[model samples]
Target: IYTGVYADGVNQANRRKSRHEQSFVAPEWGWAWPMNRRILYNRASADPEGRPWSERKAYVWWDADAQQWTGEDVPDFEKTKPPSYRAPAGADGVEAIEGIDPFIMQGDGKGALYAPQGLVDGPMPTHYEPVESPFRNQLYGQQANPTRVEYRRDDNPMNPAPPEEHVDVFPFVFTTSRLTEHHTAGGMSRYLEHLAELQPEMFVEVSPALAAERGLEHMGWCHVVTARSVVEGRVLVTERLRPLKVEGRTVHQVWMPYHWGSGGLVKGDSANDLFGITLDPNVLIQESKVGTCDVQPGRRPTGAAMRQYVEEYTSRAGVTDAEYPPIVTVSDDIVTASEDTGTQEEEDDE
Candidate 1:
């Protein structure tokens, strides 16, 4: 599919002339997939009769004189196909698709408001709280995504969520993201002295208000504690990490870069250590982006003390064993088996 679409010896001129706003599509510069068509389903930019929807926003349209589709970008439909062409009776495959249908790949050649297939959850979009969120789901009685996968193990203990007691043990929201200076987990970039010097050590970003509330000093050592593990980092008190008011309650968030590890040239505790194993049911992607953690002002304990420290918090939160949070919560009541069983109770018609 990428035959003539890549920048190479023969296609050097097109790649060199690539510029922004150059004829909008810049078909001559660079390349795109599926026969170098810059836009997908560009036929939608025109009307059923193949006239441009608007002159200012014209993209791909039919050339009436030549009786073929032509414009700034290549037409997504068959090149010689005409606007008035209709699929004959008993037609199948490409021949079955109407000329006016921009989304030819779909069964009915139309965009779906609610997907009928290709999803593990329901067909329609629905909101669910994060697996380890501090607050309850305000919009729905169902607290979190019931379809989410959980690993109920002694090592991967979950933090207490809404309707669970001792949620305050790990009150603050903790999140991890990539830093521009280093590549993912700093495997290659940390080995390079230049890149390592750019972001030498791992640091957590917090708002000034949170620092004051937690007795944390700017640029001082601080540790984030989760039921899973404890990770320490230098503190960076900045206004960029603001506290949000969710449900009229102040919610402080701690942000960290997950590019540091023990093997790297610039070593530090991994920010990912603070997350438990909760996954999206469809793709099975680990939900490590956000969770709950408690922030402390000093470096975390070492060796056996570290294990004891985590145990103390978990014991208080009532999740020290293999028992995980309930999968389904309706009106702050468990309506499903514990996360280990992954079983949900059928709803009762009230």
Candidate 2:
């Protein structure tokens, strides 16, 4: 009851003895996951010679003379087996497990640093920009994740091109999260009056600085857009959501809870409608949890006007169909975009 690790009370082998020796005396041994193993890799508690590291920190140890396992808990190692014991060549099953090695599940009975196989992409990880990003890769020439499973269906469209080639129209960084009062997608929590009352409606959290620039009113209606879709929610101007000064530019961000959906009792637009299908390479999990978007004050355009709204932004921002950045690096100096523009204009005038 004290520790949530075990279903029942710990071992009560001896009233005067420590808790370690009482593991078996419980109403039942660990009834939790991983076969009730109180502690994983218990064999490591003992040295390679099968003796405890210190008298005070003694745990699982192999009793050589008695030829048995003795400890405060069940030993994760083979009973009566000494650390000197090594499996013979061509040994199978448990016989193949070396007495000195604690991690038996591994192929070599050791931890892996570089994976030899099983990974679809390269074994090592590299930095790649997301499917939608306002900046290019600062370290390498790789603009976006080459291995990501990108999709462009009729239902699921894409956003702007790589940062170096095309200027992104969706300037602000947008992401989705869940509120404490509501459950995921508002399936169970929205129907409950108690939970629904806390968060009465869907809203977007914006920095007070961004709110001033966009002229958004507190608790006023605001629309967010992407190449895929547009969604509207109430504006929540808060100081907590502040702008980030990245590369000498004040980059604003939009945050919204994804709990609301059309099916809920408090029906509202789903934040998921903003982006199309883009998935992690190994797991194939969609990046719907977060993506980039554009925000505007007032309600979203309807019918034919919506298409025109998107097309106009695309034309203004020059959304090219370039898959990757043409030039690897933008400039030699570590200057801001504002300074770079100033220098370019001076050169043009000269």
Candidate 3:
């Protein structure tokens, strides 16, 4: 494993573990599979036909004097082979690869702009409205990933899908992400007292409009609810979160940081726990980054009362996958049209 190997919580067997799947290796080196190497697709630096793209970032280049292929990075081709040599279509090894095949990791060695295989869902990335989405799906008919995982345990209850039509009682969407000041999940940052003091308590940042609507004063206690969980934090009313205008509908967003899990020194309720196990199919990454939730003023119930609050929220906002979220559209046609015109003008000058 290279750098950035993180202990991403427990496994299915409840064992504490870590993963570093990004490492790659060179052929003839000591290591093998079951352990990924550092340079799995080093061949991609070259163009399709085994020609180097640029002399500077070149992994391999032809040496006219030596009449052989040479490179600074590991050579994706046979060491002594010349660029002019061609292997037949059915031939194995490097010869069978077309000049356009850049990513050598796959058997075919081609760069797939649109992946035909390997991904669980369709290969290309498509935006889906979150399971607890406030807006309509904009990408054709596809809503969220149909295969989104739902953990049936009592600890994780999901919201009902549309058509069944759940109530939008706590009518706001919230996203929990990392702040630059803290590391991913806050396990490391909570260990330090100075860092803990700076962000002393778990806080939920809300827009001033939402705060006023809910009768929440600045720095007051606020309760955020989702289908799965209810988390309480100090309110931080800010203007940074304005209502976004999308497709003639107003969409408001709340930003929360998911740093305070259990076992940390300055720990509080985990923001990640509020999200059900909905994930993006292509990368198998949790869609904990975005979800739907409702916020209200005042402190959350403690002990048994807290559990009731979560159950009540789940009963109201039944879970289901729905449409894709709206996106801002930008046209690249003008840029493409200018490219051909600029090339013709340059050629005329010559």
Candidate 4:
């Protein structure tokens, strides 16, 4: 389906003409041009009296002598409406819009922290575990988010958590992010040698503590395990990641650059491959930023055999693909106990 909504006509002049016209279009088809300008409802910058918020930010104001509206910037008005006009209560259509409100596109007249209408799941942002998770929710009684998605396929198996255990065998939480030099998934980087050399291959970074625990050396391969999948990458051990004491337990984290999709010169499985398409309730952004996995020092098994390798870890964890990190506890004492124990031990041994 398509809707013919072109915000820009032939030129800037024509674009301005169309701006004064009311238009609606479907999501599938629309165009903004001459810079793809998209301004929020600019009219609300003015008070009901038609004066702008400030001279620097001034856009429009009422002209009492001329009995019309005037503005140095884009005049967001009917071109002649006076400032004294009052809207009746419960008025329908444009009149119902409060004079100070700008986001008329939304149902309500405010910049809502909780959007009651647009989003499907809910309005506020809630932290949920990704499909592949290593840690349960430390902030909530529920371990992984109850709403996280799980795929039953061979490519996507979910790891499970034991009872009351927020941390799992895949002890380190892993997240994939982009490198500034490489675009997302690394399509452009593949064609360019300079970018490829800078980040030649798929690598996962771990803290020195995790590297030592796993017997992984810098630039050596480390097998990252989750119930559904396994991928091996070169290791970069650094001090940047220290164990975080969450809920009285020391939690480790790992980092991976997700720019190595299959099409690149440095080809690898999509970091997104490990991610199931669960979305944030407010903005519908995929919950791909954080997840759980175990790390081991070794080359990962290849081809069909890799699946078997991951399955072995899942079996040892004694949980099914549907389960994840156990429920979170709300006690500050429980959360901080791990750190406290370490400190007390240090003091007592002294």
Highest-scoring model, lDDT? 1
Residue range 227-312, candidate 1, lDDT tens digits: 98999999999999889999889989999999999886799999988888888988899875799999999999999999999999
Give the poorly placed runs of model 1, Cα more than 4 Å off: 1-6, 10-53, 62-109, 332-350
User: lDDT value for candidate 3?
Assistant: 0.65
What is the alpha-carbon lDDT of model 1 when measured against the actual structure?
Answer: 0.85
Clashing residue pairs in all predictions, respectively, total 0, 1, 21, 7
- Over 68-128, each residue of candidate 4 has an lDDT whose tens digit, in order, gives 7655444444555555545587776567555555566654445676866676545775665
Listed in order, each prediction's TM-score against the native is: 0.79, 0.66, 0.64, 0.63
Question: If ranked by lDDT, best first, what sequence of candidates would result?
Answer: 1, 2, 3, 4
Residue ranges of candidate 3 with Cα displaced over 4 Å: 1-100, 123-125, 262-264, 318-350
* Winner of 2 and 3 under TM-score: 2
**lDDT measured at residue 185 in model 2 versus the true structure, 0 to 100:** 86
Residue pairs with colliding backbones in model 1 are none
In model 2, the Cα lDDT at residue 229 comes to 75
Instruction: Put down candidate 3 lDDT per residue, 203-255, tens digits, no spaces.
Output: 89877778877888888888888776788888899999997887786667787
lDDT score, candidate 1, position 7: 43
lDDT of 4 at 345: 100
Give the residue spans of candidate 4 off by over 4 A.
1-97, 102-105, 113-116, 123-140, 143-155, 161-167, 281-284, 319-350
